[model samples]
Target: MSHAPTHVTCSAVSFDWPDGTPVFDGFHWAVGPGRTGLIGLNGCGKSTLLKLVAGELSPGEGQISVAGTLGYLPQNVTLDTGARVDEVLGIRTTRAALHAIEAGEATEANFAAVGDDWDVEERALATLDQLGLARIGLDRTVGELSGGECVLLRLAALLLARPDVLLLDEPTNNLDLRARHRLYAAVESWNGVMVLVSHDRELLERVDQIADLRDGEVRWYGGNFTDYEAMLAAEQEAAERMVRVAEGDVERQKRELAEAHLKLARRKRYGQKMFENKREPKIVMGARKRAAQESAGKHRIMHTEKLAEARERLDQAVEAVRDDAEIRIELPATQVHPGRRVLTLTDLHLAHGARVEGEWEVRGPERIALVGGNGSGKTTLLRTIAGLLPPASGEAVTHVPTRFLPQRLDVLDDGRTVAENVARFAPHASNNVIRARLAHFLFRGARADRAAGTLSGGERFRAALAALLLAEPAPQLLMLDEPTNNLDLASARQLTGALESYEGALLVASHDVPFLESIGITRWLLLDGTLRPTTAQEVRESRWDG
Candidate 1:
C-alpha cells in the first residue's frame, strides 16, 4: 500500500509535565506511509508523542504538522455505557439524516447531513465485522460489550472515518488471543499511514517498519520488532568490543605517563650528582639543568594530554553500551517444598457462580497458567482462591501464605508513597529493609519515595509487585490476574524476571502467551465451566471457541 509521504512531521518539539519533569526537548520525527510500530521502554514518551501528533496535546516548543486527517486511539478506551453504538461510531447525525430522508422528509439540511455517506451504516457494520464484532448491532448500547470488545469497537469507528493517518497507543493491552488476531489483521489491512505505539511483539511483527522512541527521539529501523532486536544485538556487540579496546588504550596511556615520570626523575638525580661533583663550570651545569627542567615539563604536559584524551574516549565508549538490566529479586523465604501442597481447590464454586467439577491441587513450586477468554470468570476464581470472595458452593483454600494481584492492582494504596505502601504490607520490616528490597525491584532512592497515585502505568505495576512479593510471611502461593494487562514490553519482561526469583507456587491468569511461557509454567488450566488441563502448544496454536 502506498501512503502519502511525510504524513506526520514533528520539528523541535518539547513537552514537560506540570511538575516540571521533562519528556521531550527539541525532538524531531517524520513518519511516512505504511505501518510503523513505535516501541520503547516504559515512560519514554511514546504515547505522549502520538497524542501530540493527533493534536490532543500542544507542545511547549516547536511545531507538529500532519498532512491530512488524523485519527487516534488512546491507550485507555472508555466510552459512555448509555450511549448508542452509532454515536460511538461518530455517525449518529448522518444515520438519522438518511433515516429522515427515507421517511419522506426531503429537507435540504438532512441532505447536507447525509452528504456522500448514504451507506454509512453498512460501512460501520462491515468494519465491526472485520474486527470480529459482527454480533454488536448498530443500535446496541455500549454497556452490552466486553472490555476487549470496546477496544475493537473504538477501532471500528476510526476505520469508518478512513482518515489519512491513524495513531494507536497500546491497542492490544486488554485484548484476548482471538481479539488480538483480529487486530493484527486490521493492522495488516491498513492501507493508510499508521503509527502504532505498542509493546506487543506479535502485533509489531506485522508492521512494515519500526520507530524506536528513546530519550525523546525516534530511531528508524527498516523492519519489524524481530529485525530491530537483531540489529540492536549486533550494535551492542560492536559497542562492547569498542569499550574493551578503549579500556586497553587508557591503560597503555597511564603506563606510558608513569614511565615518563620515572625517567625524568632519574635524569634529575644524575644532573644533581654532576652539579655536586663539580664535573664542569657551575654556570654551565646550571644552564644544562634549566634546559632539562624545561624539557621535562614539556614531556609531562604531552603525556598528561594524551592520558586525558584516552580517558575521554573510554568514557564515550562506556556510554555507548546499553543499560537495560532486568530486576534481580531474591525471595528465599517464599520457597515451597516439593511435597507440600500450596493450594487446594475442592469442587470449588467461583464468586461469579462458575464451578470446578473436580478438585485441583497445586504442589511444590508449580507454576500454573489460567487461560480463558473474556468473561470466563478468571478474576472471580482468583479472588475466591485468595479468600477475598466467598465461594458459592465448595471450598477454596491455601495451605501457605497467599497473595493476590488483581487486574486493577488494587493491592496498592494510591495515597501513600511506594515505600509506605510496601511497609504497609510488611510492617515488621524496617524502612531501610523496605528500601533495600524495593531497590531490587528497580525502585532505588527517591523513586521509592514517589506516591503511588503519581506513578505511571509501568511504575505502578512494579510498585504493586514489590509490595506483594515483599510482604511479611513471604507469600508461598501468589495469584495474579492479568498482571501484564497494561505493562510495556520491558515491564513485562521485568515481571517475568521477578517471577524467576520467586521460588513459590504461581497461579497467573493472563492472555499473554509469551509471558506465561517465559515464567516456566508447569501446568496450564483452561477455565471454562471447569478447569481443564491443557498444553502451552495447544494454547498458542488453537483458537478459543468458548
Candidate 2:
C-alpha cells in the first residue's frame, strides 16, 4: 500500500562540543524515504549528528525535523546488567499488561497499557530471532549476553519500535559475521527513511545512497558506496588536472610579472637618457617622464593583481583534491625467518573454560585470521600469548617478543601525551626520532604533544598503534583483537597499510572479511573449543552462535 512521504531535514544546524570544538556550522541536509549511508572520516561528527537527530543532544542553532517517530541505535550500546531482554526491547510493560488480561484480571489500566500491542511479546521474540538471538530468549538478563549479542539486542529493540525514521551509528562495530549478515538483511528490508553511519563496507554497500560528511558539510552521491567511490575517483582525477593547469597559470603569471618589471626598467632608462639629451622641450620632457612613470606604476599593479589571482586559483584547485594521509613506518627488526616458530599453544585452557585442546604452532611471518563468534576465547587466547592472562592448564609460549592490541586500545597512558606514550614504548629512541616517526602516522608537530585522553577515536587509535609498533625490541609477534572495531574506513585502511610494512607473525581476531583479505591472511583458524583450520570461503558461508 502507498503511504505518506517519510523524510528527515536539518536546517542551518550548528553544533559544537562542550570544549568549544566546532562540529557543524550552518549545516543543512535532507533525506527522503530510503537508506542513506553516512560515511566520513573518524572524528567528523557522524555520531554527534545522529545524537542530534535522535534528540539525545541539542544543536547550538537551527532546527531538526523528522516526519514521524524516530528510533536511534548508537555506536556503544549499553544495557543494565540486571535488565531482561523484554525490558530492553521496551515491551516489558505491555507484556505484563497482556499477561494480566490473559490471567482474567481485565483491568482498565492493563487494557490501556496494552493498547494496539497485544502481540508485543510475540513480536519481540520474532525480532530477536530475526537478529539471530532466538536462543537468548526474552527472559535472559543482559549480564549473560556477549558483546556481539548486546549489539544485536539493541538493534532488535530499534527494529521492534519500527519508527519511520531510523538512525544507526556503527551498529556493526562489535557484531560477529552472522550478526552482521542479519543486520544487512534488516537494512535491505527496511522501507522507511534510514540513515546509518558505519565503516563496514558490506553494510555500506546495501544503502540506496551515500552522504559523505566532510569539512562540516554533507555532499550527496546518487548511489551506494561503490558508486560513491567511483564518482569520487573521477572527481579527484579532475581536481588533479585543475591543479596542474592552475600551477602552469601561476608560473606564467610570474614570468609575465618579471617581464613587466624589465620593461619598466628599460622605459625609465630610456626616459632618463631622453631628458638628459634634451631631445624635447623641458615641459615636454617632464610630461613624458611623468607619463612613463604612471604607466610603469599601472603596469606593476596590474601584474601583481594578476599574479595574486592566479595564486588564489592554485590554492582553490589544491583544496579540491583530497589529502588523506597514509601511515608509513619501517620495522626491520620485526622480520621473522621462514623456519622460525613465533607462537605455540599446548592444550591451552583459558579462564572461561574454553580450551585450545591440542598443540598449535605459528611459524615464520604467517598472518593468521582468528574467526569465531563473540566470547569465543579469541581475546583470551591472545592475552594468554601476550602474558597478560595465565593459561589455566597448558601454556601459550611466544618465541619472539609479542604485543597485544586490545579492542579498547588501552595501551596508551591517557594522562601522557602522544609523544610521551610513544617514547614510553621506545625508551631508547631519541625525541626527534619519535616525533619524526609520528609525523608519518599523521600526528605532525604540536599534535604529537596532545594528551592521549583528549584525542579522538581515530587519533587515539593511531597513537596506540604508534606506541605498539615503536616498542623496544620490536614486536616480532603482534596480536590485534578486533582491530577495526571502532575505526572509520580511512583509519581502518591506515591500519591495513601499516600492517603491510610489518614483517612479524600476525594474529588478528576480526569479523572484517575484506580487511583480513586485504592484509593477505595466510591462515584462517576458527576459534570455538578448538582451533580448527578453515578457508576464507568456508568462513564466509558458515554461521556461528549468537
Candidate 3:
C-alpha cells in the first residue's frame, strides 16, 4: 500500500559552479525520516546539495520539496568569542523573552509570537536538561566554552527546536572521546531524519546509507562504509580485468594490420613485375593494373585506419576506470636504539589547577592511550612526556628521543614546498635524501613540489610526518596528538597500519576509537587533571566519570 510521501524528495537535480563547472549533475536522492550520512571527499558537492535542500541555494534545474520543519548546524561561522556558553544558547529566544518581561507585557499572544510555544523559564531549563545542559547558567555566556563545548551547545540548541529533520555538517570536528560518544548516543536515539556530513569514518559507519560524490555524480551505496568498500573492491577488480582484455585486443589488432600491409606490399611488387615483363595485351594489362592498384590502395587505407584504431584502443585501455586511493606512506626507521626503559613516569603528579597526587605513571614499549574531553589535559600530558612541559614535581625519566605531533599541525612549514618542509624539519639530511623521504609519504611527483599550505588535510599530515621522520637518533618514542583530525577513512587506516608496524613505543591522544583499536592500544590513562589507567572497554561504557 502506498502511504503519504516523505518530506524530502528531489527530482533531476543539476547545478554548476560560477564558471560553468558542473558540481552535481542529474543526481537524485529521496531521504526518509532516518539517519543518512552524506559521505564524500572534501570539496565534493555535499555542501552545495545541503544548501539546495535547506533552500539556501536554488537548484539550477528540477524540483526540490522539503516539507515540515528543518534544523541545521553549519560547519563554521562567526561566533561571539567574548560571550559565555549560556548566552549563546539562549541569545535568540532569551532576548525576546527579556524584552517581553522588561516591558511588563508577558501576554500569552506575545509569547506565541516570539516562538512556537510560550517562553517559560521552566521550559528552557527542561530543554537544557534533555540536552545535558540543565545546570549551566544563562548568564555565563559563550566565551567560556571551548570548541567541543560550543559545538555541543549549538547541537543542543538545534535539538530544542524539535525539528522533523536535522542537518549536521562535520558534527564531530572538534569533539573529544566523551563528547563524540555523547553525540553518537544522541543521534542513535534520535527518531527524526538526520543528514550528517563528516569525514570521521567511525561517525560515517553509524549512518544508514553512504553516498560517494565524485566527478559530478552521486554514487550512493545502500549500506555503511564497509559495504561501500566491498562493492568498490569488486568493481575495481572487474574494471582491472576489462582493461587487460582491452589491451590484448589492441595488440592483436595491431598485429593483424601489420600482416595486411605486408601482403599488400607483396601484391604491388608482383603487379610491377607483370607490367615489366609485358606478358599480355595492353588493354588486358591495363585492366589487371587497375585491379591491382585498387586492391593495393584499399589495403593501405585499411591498414592505416586499423593502426589508428588500435592506438586509440591502447589509450583507452591504459586510462580506463581505476580507484585512485592516496594512502601509500612509509614510516621512517628508528635510529635511536630505545635504551632499556626509554621512558618511565612512576607515581607522577599532574594538575589542572591543583595537583592530583601519586596516581599516574607509564613505562616504555607500551602503546598507551591518553583519552579525555577538551581542557582535560590530554595535550598537557603528551607535552609533559615529550619534554615540552616539565612536571611540577614527579619522578619522570625519559631515556629515549621522542617526537611529538602537536594538534595544531605546526610541525610542517606552511610557506615552503612539501619537500622543502621535510628538509627543514630534518636538517641533517641532504636535499635528495629529504625528497626521497617526502615521496615515501605519498607526496611524490608534482605533489611534493606543491607548498605545504596548498595541500589537503591528509597531504599536510604526510608533510609533517616527513619532517618528524628526521628526529635525531630516530626517536623511539612517538607521541601523536589528535592525528586523526580531518583525515579521510583510507588515509587514517593506512596511517594506523604503518604505526602498528613500528617497533617503537607510541602514546597517542586521539578520539578515533577505530584507529586506536586497529593500532592495538592496550590500557588507557584517563585524563581529568590527573591520570588513571583503565581498560578500553571501561572507557567506552562510562560517560563523564572521573
Question: In the order shown, what is each candidate's alpha-carbon RMSD?
Answer: 2.3, 2.5, 5.5
Candidate rank order under lDDT:
2, 1, 3
Residue-level lDDT of model 1, residues 114-224, one tens digit each, is 999999989998999998888878999999887788899999999988898999988997788888899999999998899998878899999999898877777888898
In candidate 1, which residue ranges exceed 4 Å CA deviation? 1-6, 104-109, 351-353, 388-392
What is the clash count for each candidate, in the order shown? 0, 0, 9
The Cα local distance difference test for each model comes to: 0.88, 0.90, 0.70
What TM-score would every model get versus the actual structure?
0.94, 0.93, 0.75
Better of 1 and 2 by lDDT: 2
What TM-score does candidate 3 reach? 0.75
lDDT of 3 by residue, 401-503 (tens): 7888986678877778887777666678887877676665666677777777656566677677667755556667788988877566656765776575566
Instruction: Pick the TM-score winner.
Output: 1
